[model samples]
Target: MSDFIAEQDRVLLERHGLASYEALWALTLEAVDEPNTERGGWSSVYRLDLGEQAFYLKRQSNHLTRNVLRPFGEPTFAREFRNIQRFKRLGIPSLEAAFFAKRRINTERQAVLVTRALDGWSDLQGLLESWPRLPGVERGEIVTACGKLMRNLHAAGQLHGCFYPKHVFLQRSSGGYAARLIDLEKTRPLLLGERDRLKDLDPFLRRTCAWSDDEVRHFLTAYLPIGTDIERWRLRLDARRRSKEFAVGAC
Candidate 1:
């Protein structure tokens, strides 16, 4: 397939022998300890190794009919590339795109996006799974940091549509803990309303992190101002939790 490489990445692209989209998909990829492979009927992802470094590569294809409702075509790779730029511009820690390409043949469209690997990072899910092993004071500090990060993201008028535990990556820096959100294909502009902000927090609390009511209240205190209507936020979170419990029981 045809391709395009940024001028700055020309040498790296050439060195990796990734000149075309076809070549990139054909290259051998190494499996990490994590479940790095994500597969679906129309898309797939792989963690690729280039010498000692690694990259995250995602490939997607769709029929022209699926592109009818999309304005700039269904090139999700490009969408992710732009979203990563948005996160960085907003001063939110995130990944970097190393390469992107879109190709069309007749009525079919295909795209690929490669991102520089996050080497020394771990998903919040893994950390939370080992939560009991961590010191209580350290855990409280992490939750507070997460709350501040969420507050900053919402204040910037952006929403991470799928804010699940697995999508949040954490790393320990000299200063403290650094957190970043990933899988930004569904990210969109946030409206100027608490409803919009709550939408992000609800699923994150219900489906992702397993924080209790008291913990949620504590987090919101750091997420919002001291005298904010925290009671209202707690009510909303409780409703979300009950609804999730009901849905699971019904199934």
Candidate 2:
């Protein structure tokens, strides 16, 4: 069993009597979403409001995943905690963990993860649903920002495995708009080659069906290098979409 708490958040968590694993384990709060039950266990997230500050507390019991490195299985939140730190070190914008702990009590493995909230950020899916109501310039700015974010993440040799619109978040920053990612449970180091880019971007393109060809071109212009063939990428992604559709239909 082990525990960690960010120094910056110590005072706040301590003040709320939640600085220890026992405190957090026994703490009761309203769940933000339905509990996820899988892998012979369950996990849930709760919104914790400490005065004016808000934090997300995730709790899980025996929820495990088996990978090549840990065939015996390990807590999923433990992997997510490590990935959060990796994103911070890579200078990628993502969730910030405030507290993390994992314990083994007899046959049950339990874990807790807490993160600071992105107060003013909005998910891309929500924004896209209202794209038509948004001004043309605002839409362009957001798309361009999101494109740059994707480019930077790929350049850093990272992959946001689940790069859906809901996982990508945007906020109006002092320098126009800034993009951040959430739901890093599936995120990992990117493999070499252009196929890696397609792996992440394909789902994004498929999900954002509201985007016109022109808007997609604008996004590619921002993501690809100058003089790069944007149309080629468009064609490749279109092929991938078709392949995925066929696979789904055949099932």
Off by over 4 Å in 2: 246-251
lDDT string for model 2 (63-84, tens) is 9988999999999999999989
| Residue pairs with clashing backbones, model 2 | none
**Candidate 1 lDDT by residue in tens digits, 137-166:** 666766776787788788888988877778
**Model 1 lDDT on a 0 to 1 scale:** 0.72
The prediction achieving the highest TM-score against the true structure is 2
How high is each candidate's TM-score? 0.81, 0.95
After superposing candidate 1 on the true structure, give the runs of residues whose Cα lies further than 4 Å from its correct spot.
1-10, 28-41, 63-73, 240-251
In candidate 2, how many Å is residue 75 off?
A: 0.6
